[model samples]
Target: MDCTTVSLPFEMPADACNVHLHIIDPAFPNDGKAASQIGTVETYQALVNKLRLPRAVFVQAKPFALDNACLLDAIQKFGPDNARGIAVVNNTISDQGLEQLHNGGVRGLRFSVWNPDNAVVSFDDCAPLSERVKHLDWNMQLHMGAAQLVKWADIIRRLDCKVVIDHMGRLDPALGVKDPAYPFIQEMIDKGNTWVKLSGPYLNTKTGEPWEDATRTAVAIAEFAPERVVWGSDFPHVTEKIKPDEVVLTEMIATWLPTKKARQLALADNPKELYGFV
Candidate 1:
């Protein structure tokens, strides 16, 4: 779908933040793992204009691996007042490096266990790193599949800082709320330090477009913790061969939250608090 041609049916709150997106500018060198298509800050600004989501969190894309120059540069260009970042780093980073990232408006560190072969940081690095950044009040953002979620449930619960689960825990929509991992997800949310991002529905959907099957899992999470949820466009959708229309993705929040107040929390309030956006 041509996302640029589409517009949201309703106005988003002034502070609404798109908590998950990437900035892949070719101006920066990469480790040859970047997305096939380049997603520059200018390209993302067009999407921000189209979606009318004024705030954002620039997640460090995998292509750059541990080199956060592209992500940090995008945040600076976008203006830190309206942008925050989540970087990918390991325990070996110096204290000065961490502070530099913190000053760069980075409030979280992302660890991916889904693709270990290509992952920059492993599950083993999550705990110590979480502790390392705890004093900075940075959260630990996790990207893992359902099986990995179950496998790391114990460690996730014991983490020293806030947790944000990427892509709705990468749950399989075919399983819906009955997925065995659902219980683990519930426990994490009930712990009050964890949040779920209502993004990437297209990744696991059995039904396309409106993605009803995936929406069910999102609705269940919203019902479980309305204030503990946030929304993301997963913009540039690097993983998909055909990108899903982002307008449809934005509108899905209405069905997932089912109320203006709930939408307010997920869209605006929750993100401000979690990302430490002023």
Candidate 2:
């Protein structure tokens, strides 16, 4: 619905501060407060200060995906200070409400099972919330499809912890990414404790230059192990009808990594060492 109309070709580096970004509008409300997409959080912080993003990690989509807590107090009040979060689990979550969302900088825990009638959590009840979120080291954000990635690949291989298969694994680009579930995400990136997010190629490109099927699936996932490839700009892109503009999603990530040192290690040192962002 004119979801932030997009159009891009360039403009991102003005001495880009190690390309920092982490925005989440997973419909941004969970009843700890806030809505109207939280008044677009100053219009997504003025589009990350007009795309000179130095740091941003605002997230909120599961304060038990909302029945009341006012969207987790409006994501702790319009999330900032390099915000970071991801929540939503029920079974009356306790352990002090998961240690008050792990001291309110939640690492991760999103599960959607891609429209099992808007599932809140499944994939076998996410192994006791992945065993109480593996004692708070979190990370279990699945949005599966790609034939359910080898039927949840042994529940992401016996859930020993750490996992984040969001967009890439949704690969289908008309089954051209050598589909066979692309070798089940190349055996979960050769089991070096999985992590992935070559961010949603417009929901797996039915065509419209979603980086031409996400640039050969991001060079076959940076040759299947570029330190567990990471990238994101899914910002405010909920239920897209073609909405992705943050300088054209950073020039479609420099045309999907067309160099400039693999676009400064996939947009600044691989998500600052995979979300430890410093």
Q: Evaluated with lDDT, which candidate comes out highest?
A: 1
Candidate number of the best TM-score: 1
Q: What's the number of clashes in each of the models?
A: 2, 13
Which regions in candidate 1 have their CA more than 4 angstroms from the true location? 1-7, 33-35
Error of 1 at 211 (Å): 1.7
lDDT of 1 by residue, 88-186 (tens): 988889999999999999999999778888788877889998888899999999999999999888888899789999989888788977888889888
For model 1, name the residue pairs that clash: 33-63, 34-63
Model 1 weakest lDDT span, ten residues long: 1-10
lDDT of 2 by residue, 1-278 (tens): 22343444444442232211233333643434333223344566566556555554444443335232433443455453355556657656778877777676666667767778767666676767878878777777777887887776777777777777877887778774788877877787687767777776777777765558666786677656766766667666665655765566666666666556665665556555545555
What is the C-alpha local distance difference test score of each model? Answer: 0.87, 0.61
lDDT at position 182, candidate 1: 82
TM-score between candidate 2 and the true structure: 0.32
